[model samples]
Structure formats: C-alpha cells, structure tokens
Target: MKRSIAQLKEWFRRGKYPTESQFRDWLESYVHKDETVPVSQVEDLPRLLNGKFSTSRGESVEREAAALRLKFDRHKEDADDEFEKIENNRQALVAEDERQQGEIDAQQAQINTATGQLETVRKLLHSGASWTTVKAAFDVLGGNYSSLWALANTVKTFLEASDTSDATINRWQELESFLQGITDTDSLTGLLETMKQEIGTAYLNDLRKTADELSGIPATYAELVERRARGGMLPGTLYRITDYETMVANDPEARSAGHPFDVVVMALDEHTLSERAWAMHSARDAAGYFGKSKLEAWQVWYCLDNDDTRFQWADTTRGKGVIYRLIDEWGNDCPYDFKNVQFKRCNTTGDFVDNVVDDADWPNTHYILSPSMNGQADMTADETDYKWLYTFTYLEQMQDVRDASLINEVNADFESAYYNKACNCNEMQAYYIGEFIDDTTFATQALNNIVLSSYDEENGAAVKMYGNKWGAGCFNMTFHEHCYGNSFGVNCYCLIGFKLYYNTFGNDCDGNTFGNGCWYNTFGNSCGGNTFGNDFYRNTFGNSCVGNTFGNYFQYNTFGNSCNGNTFGNYFRYNTFGNECYNNTFGNGCNYNTFGNDCDGNTFGNYFWYNTFGNECYNNTFGNDCDSNTFGNSCGGNTFGNYLQYITAGEGVKYLNVTGGSDVKHFVQNAHILNGTSGKDSKNLLTVGLPEMSTVCRYVGQNTAGVLKIWVPADLV
Candidate 1:
C-alpha cells in the first residue's frame, strides 16, 4: 500500500496526467492497501478527494449526463416538434375525440418514460450515487411524463400506485383558514414562512397519520428517509421535523467558493433529464438564499428543456440579493437553471453521446455528459456539459431582441402625432420626467405644445373632455392647474384665474375617486389640494369623502363629490363661487367658513351660522340680490371674518382664505348633523343686501323649521 501511494505521488510529481481507467486502477489499489488505508481513512477517501479536487459532483454529473442524453435525443426531438406544433396550432382539434386521443397517447408514452426514469432516481438516491446518476433521471422526467410532478417514492420512480388518492383539499382549506385566523396574512413573506411551518407541523402530519392509520401506501427507502430515527415524523426527501439548521449548528450552505465553473449538460429538449436539471439551476438562481444558507460561487448545468434547437429566455445568470430556501434539494446546488443559452451550447458543441457507448436507437442514456475536445479519448469535461454552466446575459442586454416576433417595421410620420403619444409620452409610470397632461392651463400650456382637452362640437356645454384625447381608461385622469392650454377657452374648467380640474396636473389631480363628474377633489394650483383632499390617511387606506359642504348644497345625487364626513359643521361659505358639489364627503363637519361675503352665482342663497361664514347667518345663509346668474356663479361656502362684499356672478373671492393656517373647526363636532342646506338656490345669483343674519331673518328669510335651528340645531353654538 505504501509503495502504491508512493507510485501515485510519483506519477503526480511527474506531471503525467493519468487516464480515468489508470486513475481508477490506482484508486482501487490505494483503497485496498494496508489492506488499503485504515477503515476510517478509507471511508473518508471520497470526501477527502472531493474537498481537495476541482472536480465536483456537478462536473461528474455533467460528464455522465452528456453521455446519457444522447440515447434519448431522437425520441425527445420528435416529441419536441410534435408538442410545439400542437401548441402553435391554436385552432387545432385538440379538443376533439381523435386528436385528444392522439394527444393522450403521446402524453401516456411520455408518462411511461418518466415512470421508467423515476426508478433511476430512487436507485441513485438510495445508493447515495453521484448527482450525475440522480439528475440523469430528472433531466428527462418532465419530457417523459405528461405530468410535471416528481414523486420519487412511487414504484420504479413512476406514477404507478395511482394512490387512488384520498384528497384532503377540504382539510387543507380548513387548515389555511385556521392559520389565517391566527396569522397576520398581510405580511406575505412572513405569512408564507409561517404557513410552511404550520402546514408541515399540523395538516401534513395529519395526512401522514391518516396514511399510517390506513396501513400506509407502499414504502421505499425514500419512505425511510421520510421518518426520523427518533420518535419524530417528517415528510419525504425534502423536510425534517428538526430543522437541519438547528441540528447542524454549523452552516453547511456557505457557498463563497468563488464564481462557479461553467459546465454543459445534455438532456432531451422536452423536459429531458438535463433539461430538468437546468430548470433546477434556474430555480436556484431565483432562490438566492435558503433560510440561513448563503448561496455563493454556484455553477449551473442547464440544457434545452423544450426543443434541442429552440431556446426560451429564462433570465439572468447571477443574482445579487438574498433569497430563501428551506431545503437542500439536489444537495445545495442551484435548483432550476434552464437558461436558453445552455441549450444552444449543448446543441452546437455537444455530440449526442447517448451513453458511454454509441448506439443506433435513442434508447436510454446515462445523463447529460459530453466529450471533452482536449481530454483523453471518450472523456468529457465537466464545464462543457450543461446550460447554466455557461455565461448568462443580462436582461438589459437582451431587451431589444427579446420576443420580437410581433415587431412590425412601420415608418413613423415625420411631423405627425400618434394617439399613444397623446399623453406626454406613452408610459405615465413612476419616475418618467415628461410633461404630463394633467396640470394648470396657465403654466403647463407654455411648457408642452399639445393640449389634452378640446373645444365642444355642439353648443360646447363645457366640453368636459376638452382638448384631451380620450384613452381607453383615461376618464377623469386630468389635472386642471397643470393644463397649459387656453384657460379662457369655453371648455376650460372652473373660473379663468383658477385652474380647477380633476387630476389637475400629472396623474395626481385625482378627482375620479368619487362618483362621475364629481370634481371637488379638483384643486386649482395645489396638486393634491382641496378642502377635504389629500389629508392624512389610515395605514394604507384613506377615509372616503362621503357627506359634506360649507352650505347645504353638497349632497350626493345633486353634487359631484361626497360631502359626508366634513369636519367643518355646515359652514358652507368661502366657496367663493364653487358649485354643484354634491356627494362631497367631509372627514368630520364643515364649519368656521365665512359663507357670508362672496356667495356669488349660487343655485341657493343659504348660509351656515356663527364662526365666520356661520357667525352671521344661523339658518342657512341664503344670499340673493342680483338676479343675474346660475350654478358656477352662485355664492357658496363664504367667510364672514372678511367683511361682507358684493361679488359679481361667476367671480371668485380669495379674501375668505388664510395663507398660513385657519381655525376651520372653531364651532362644532359630529359634522354629520350639519348636512342640511339644499342646493336649490337658483333665483338671486347676487346678494340681496349686506344685511346681517339678524336683520335678514326678520324680513327676507322663510319660516322653514325654526330658521337658525331649522336645519341643524346641533351646529349653532
């Protein structure tokens, strides 16, 4: 034994690269030396070699897979085209009896193939064979079977038992519901983990117990792995009752070995064994981390999963973030790495080495192993065996050519505008710096040349859509203040000076949340500014504007916005000629507004009492002197703090507003009680006189439900 060891060392020092058979002979000799080394050292030889050598489980697997893949190439290729043709024929009679029967036959054939392959997986896993033997089966598993599932515990690794399965969907449903009741389902990531743990602990155990109660299904060596030696029970293959992390204390998943070496893998195009293995690589790439395991310096071997020639873009080769994994499936290699490029590599350079030996039939292959160009005869390099083992491209690099089948080569008009470009640019997604359609007509018109709204075709009843081009889902997606078009145009929204429109600028002018045409959320220059607009919200959700108004005018059916939750108690003044605001919602009550001064062009002459607008009138301050105008010109939501003045119909008043801050809720609570004044004031669009509520009530007001306390005795202090 010592002499043989010296000879082997001498050979290494001589730089004489031994052939595989020679190396195998030397290894066998060494193992038996001294009788071979000690029993303990003999057992440790494989690990010692694996730890020190560049050759890894992956490399071995690639060599074997490349060889095995050839035997199944022809059958797999035929299957690939057949499936592709079937998939492409959208109107094919796949649903008909004969065609369906044919599909069934094909699918059954594959299923049988998969079943045959499963035996290999079990045989390899049980024997603790190299990953090459194990993955050779998976590479072709999907292509060989109609189903995409892998039940390694089934007969010969195929779906034979039928399990005639006792489905526990209802039980699963109940368990999910139970977990949801106790868990914060809102935290998706956390909840998923919790669900995984809970399901394994409870429902899965129950199912297993039921199986045991029923004398269990057929058992295998895989089943033995499913149970712990201790009293604890566990699921098959993947999980354990005691977390491996907790048990090992040592982290076995640290992969900081440096960048992985590329390896080519061979497999049938239609979910061939190598293809399945490649998919596993992709899955691993996506799963950057696994529980506490750090995946680093990982190489992958992906092959054509669909067709030998055709490749579908999977994604990037490297990931730079943390991804979670709870299992060490495939012994901690990347799970699914079916990069399309890997397929191309195999097809181009790989010789269909169906097995270690070439055969005529596309019968069984060992695994996706390939012949190394410069290596010993009949030997394949590990790196040249699979897909993910090769370089992967970035998404940005492939952006131009990705899925370009529908690309039409049409010439763009030199000086014409298209509908897709109507809104500044086609995409209004976040971070885009283009000029948006929703904005004030005063400023935006100077910046952007195109106008969103248009002049009305008919009597031009304020062509609401205005110059704005209509998009499929662009209703109410406007910003009045940001609109740079002609503000004085007949169709321009609100008063000329004030640019008021829903989504007035950008996509945030946002008045469409309410009922149709209800534009109270429409603010002039302030983007998200309205009396009750853009306030603080509750968590992710916001309070809805339901019932509200400074005066009795903002109701649901009659007005545009909701006036339900106004904090100001019935104080509908200082609106300075805003109109038809039905459905306006106040978070509380509407109060303290000076509904006294510029109540111009209002449909009704109503006023709220006490604070400012409410300070003067107790009943509903109905101001009507000039019989000149209607709705938008009506005097509404005025302030009494500013001295009462005569505002012409259609004119707006700003004196009623405060620059820094105003005590909007000086008088009432429970703002819902203040919802009274009707929007029925059409007669005197002008103020009758500058008389106080004391004098007006005596001569000019109606005896409706106790005047001051008539509508709401609750709001009056």
Candidate 2:
C-alpha cells in the first residue's frame, strides 16, 4: 500500500524528505495501476491541468497532485533556509578559531624567543660574569650590530676583559654552542636587543676602565700578597679590592638588595697587613659582602685585641640598612671602638640617636648597644664589660622614627613584652612622658600597661593621657574627680587640657580653671585657656566659665555664672548640677558644638530656661520660666519662645515655631519639618512619614502663604 497525502505531508514537516522511489510510490497512489490512459485521451491532460476535469478520478488526481506539489515545495524551501543557516554558522566558527589560533601562534613565538634568550644569559652567567658585567657587554653590543657573529664575538670579548676565571671560558663554550644552534638571525637580533634595553647601559665606562688595565692593581689575593712582600706598595697606601662573587650578586634591582664589594682598603702595620687582607678575602668567601660597595676612609689603628682595632675618620656615603658609622669623637680602650660602630639592627642611620630619637633615657633591648654608660673605661667595669649596652625596649616611644617596618617590629615586641612581663611596671611608669602619651601607638598599649599618676595639681600629668582606654579603673579612681572619674587636667589654680576621653564608664571631668569639680568629659580637650571654669562645685557666684569649661557645676542663687569666651564647653553641665536659676548665664561659647560641648547663640532666661539635654543644639531661644524645655540632640534653629513646659524634643527637628503655648505634648521624634509650627495646646499631631520615592505632600494645616510647611505622602497618613 502507498502512503497517503497526510502521511507524506507529516513526513515532510518533520524534516523527512521523500526519495525518488518513495515519490514514485506516492504518485502512483493517486492513480490506479490498472487504469491505463489511451494515447487519444493524453490530449485531455491539458484540460486536466486547466482544472476542467469531468471524472472523479481525474479530479482526485489533480487534487492529490496539487497537494503533493505544495508539500514538496515547502520541504525544499525549509531545507534551503536551514542550509543557509548552517553555512553561516560554520563560517563564524571558522573565523573565531582562526583568531584564537593566531594568538596562540604569537604567544608560542614569544615563548621560543624568551627560551633562547634565557639560554644565552644562562651561559653568560655560568662563566663567572656578574650581572653588571654581562649587562655592560650587552650594552656595548647595542642595537646597530650588523651580524649575529658580531654580536656573539663582542659579548665574548667583553666577558674575557671583565673576568679571567676558567669558569668564564667554560661557560663561554656553552654559550658558543647555543649561538651556533640558532639558525634564525632575526630571532637572535630581537633577543640580544631586548637584553640590552632591560639590563641598561649605565655602567659602560666602569666596565671599559676595568677592561683596560684591571684597576692598575693586583687583581688576585695571591698576586697582592706577592706584590706587597716584594715592597711594591707601602703600608699606609689605600688599595682597591674586588670580590667576583659579590659583583655577580650585586644587582640591587633584585629582591635581595645585593651587597657589592667595591671598597678601598689599606693595611696599618706589617703584622696587621696579612690580617686585613685575610679579613677582606674571608668576608667575600663566607658572608658574600658587607652591604656596602665603597667608602672613603682615613684609618687610625691601635692594638686592643691583637691588632683588631681601627677608627674610621670619614663618614658613610649612603643612608639605609646596616652601615659602619662614626658614633662619637672619643676613643675609649676597646677593640670594637665607638668610631666605627655598625648601626645594623635599627634599619636607620647612626643619627637615629641624635636626629630622630634624642632621648637620654632610652630603655634597653638586645639590638641597641650603649658604649658610653659605665664609670670605668676599663673592661673590668662589669662582668660583660663592653662599653655598649644594647637595648630594644623603646622604638615605639620614638615618634620621629617613622620606619613602618621597624615600628611594626617594635609593636609586635611591645605586645609580647606586655604579655610576658618583660616590660616591668617601673619601666612602663617612666614611659609616661608627654610625647609617648600624645602619639598614636601608646593609646592601644595603654589598655594593659599604663598606670596613671593620681591627681597632681602641680603639673597636670594625669590629664595629658590622650586616647587612653579605661579598661581598668584609672589610678584607683572612683568618683573622686580624678582624670578618669570626673575632673581631668585640673590643678589648684588653673585648668589644663583633659586629652583622653574614651571612657565607657568613668566620668572624665576636667578641672581646668576651677579648683575641684570641673569635668572635662569625653573626647573633649577641655583645658587650654587661663580661665577655664572658675568657682566650680558650689562656689557659684562670679564663676569664670571661660576657655574649655567642659562640664562644671557653678551653683549660686543670685547672679548666674557666665559661660563666656569658652573655646569648647564640651560636655559642660552648664550650671546643670543644681537649680542654678538666678546666677547661671551661659555666655559666649565658641564654634565647636560637639556632644553638647558648646550651646552657641542659645538665649535662656532665669528660673530653669537654659537646661540643654541634647548635644550640639544651636540657636534655640527659650523664654523665661520655660523650665526643662530641652532642645533634643542635634536639633538646630528651634524657637520655643513661650510657656512651653516638659517639651522633650527629637533629633534634627528644626525650626519649630511655637509663639505662645503651654502644656503642649510636643514629642516630635525625628519629625523633619521644614519651617513648621504647632497651635496653642496642640496635642499629638504626627507628620506622616513617607517612602523616599513618594513625592506627595501631607500637611496638618492649610497651605497658607509665607508660612512654609513641610509635608509627607498622603498614603503614609
């Protein structure tokens, strides 16, 4: 049986195209195999094609043929569209593959060139050529070299002139093998030029001079000893020494900060000559270099430890790391004399003592030595009778020593000492100087170490402890108005600065101008000017509340104390302890409105008008008999000029104009009003808060002209 039109169409729709034999089978299904058409009736095919068929089989043939033709055409169109899409996709993939392959090929080229250059440099270094010498050879080769042979031969010639070691000849043979293997001239040229540019050409002249006459001196230790024994050179004459290994390692551009041995040395006496020569040779073979290349020197030798004594007259040339420097002008009887002491462990210059940290009483650690301490200059002054007493106790105390590396080390050591009881109590007590207390480091250390001096009216020593966190009670203090209790920086006559204020529990009150109970409270430096806050703690009349009167109680029932010309009335309980109704007038407090520090330009009348609870409240005018009307914390420009009682305000509630009102429950808690007011005895009117994006306005009163009212969204109401 033949397949139907529906089946063929379904097959075509699912991307199954009919073959030639299948198409023939489908065409035969429309017409019977036995029903043969005569040659006379073949003329009627045109009539059938023109849709003028009479018989049902003829019409069936036409309908089925048309349906099959349409299906075939649709299949052809779909196949053509899919073929175009596949071809386009294939092209795009080919493009992307070509792009990635190009990058890979370029990267491989770079790798090959780098490998070749590395092989070249390896051979050069193996020949006992220092990086500086090899670099100089590449510099002489330059970019304008004509042939590969020229480049190779020039580098080899420079190497021969630089080093006479057999290792250089052997390594040069390896380098020659590598050069002969390089078939490509372009690759060789690129590698050599790159090496030259990277290594620089700064020391071309130095290399040339070395090549000419080899420093005009005996280049070897054996040669030097032979020449000296033959009396070719005198004892006091300076001679230049070379360490080949040091020169190879002398690349300061490397991470190790290389030590170059290019120093000028001379012998003192005939006995000491061999020793000095051996010292130089042994130092090179063992320790690499002395961290210095050259030094100008005038030496004076003396016998202390069998000819181990020399005083250097000249100074060091450079300024970092370990260096032998002139310590003092004195020559006390010691082999390791004060003249050429190595300032090694300090990571700074010898002037670190005089210039940076000039403290006569610096504490002892193992790293620093004191050679000028004991009475006797003899070795029998003590058991370990070296003049120097090395110490590492107090680098944190040196504020001028800003080397973060050394200071970080000191901080770690200090922390360990605190835990280990290495820094004892008396030593820590002596560390309570002005600079140490004022700096950034001791603040954190003060948690465990500091024991402040009890209230001294003479020097105000307890008050100057800036950034001291009161973990324990400050100086056995409990409510006695000490530095941590209530009053800080307070003497018998005047008030000094109460610097430290990180008090979680203690009341850090400062007695700057006043005698006893003047509180220079929290984070407020409240004792600078002469008249801080006088007549404090019950001596109320004529109290001079000026210049850093933080929080002092001046109580008298007559003429209130004036808070005038105060730099910072910081945390100043402004006549706040007692009912200072008559004699407490807050005068000119300055600009710093910190945590209720200074209530600048705030007018308060008699009988409880000037009671500020909120910190940093500015320009609030409260009328007389308006007792306890606190403009809440950070509330600015609020006018409560009437009979307003018990009005506890909110944060940042600005410009609340209440002309004449009494018994108002005006609890505006974060109600950010822009020039709004309350009616007489107005109760509990909440300004609706809204989402930040909502622009709608909801006001309590009518939108009157010139009376600017702030609003929130209506949906919030």
Candidate whose lDDT is highest = 2
Instruction: For residues 1-717, write the lDDT of model 2, one tens digit per residue.
Output: 477878767656766887887777777765446586565556677665778546998889999999999999999999999999999999999999999999999879755655556555556644535656665654543422223334445664554467758887888677667555444433544455444543444345456655644333434544445555676665565454453211111111111123333333455554334223212222443453332211222222221121101112111222111112111111111112221221222111132223212222232111122222111111111224221111111222232211111111223333443222211111111111112322432321011111121222332222121122322212211111123322222211112212122222212222222223333332222212323232233222224333333222332212123334432222223343211122123433211111243345555433333344455455665544454444455555556554444445555555556443333342222223332343222233233222221223333232555334445555565
Q: What is the TM-score of each candidate against the true structure?
A: 0.18, 0.21
The local lDDT score (0 to 100) that residue 285 gets in candidate 1 is 32
Model 2 Cα shift for residue 655 (angstroms): 34
Candidate 1 regions with alpha-carbon error over 4 angstroms: 1-697, 701-717
Full-model lDDT for every candidate: 0.27, 0.35
**Candidate 1 global Cα RMSD:** 39.3
| Model 2 lDDT on a 0 to 1 scale | 0.35
Candidate 1 yields a Cα-based lDDT of 0.27
Please provide, for model 1 over 1-717, each residue's C-alpha lDDT reduced to its tens digit, 9 standing for 90 to 100.
133667777666665887676677676675555464564666677777668545687799888898888858977999999999878675466457678899999989876776576445434434444434433554565422213222322212222233433454554455445334333434433433333343334445656676653432222223322333332332221211111010100112111222221122232222222221111211323333232222223333332112111111111222211111111221221122211112111111123232211321211111122222222222343544332111111111111211111111222432222211111211111111123333522211010111122111222112122222211112112221112221221112111111223322222222212111223232222122122222211101022222222212232211112222222323232232112222222222232232332222222222322222211121123221211112112224432222222222222321121111112322112111122322233232222232222211111222466232222343344
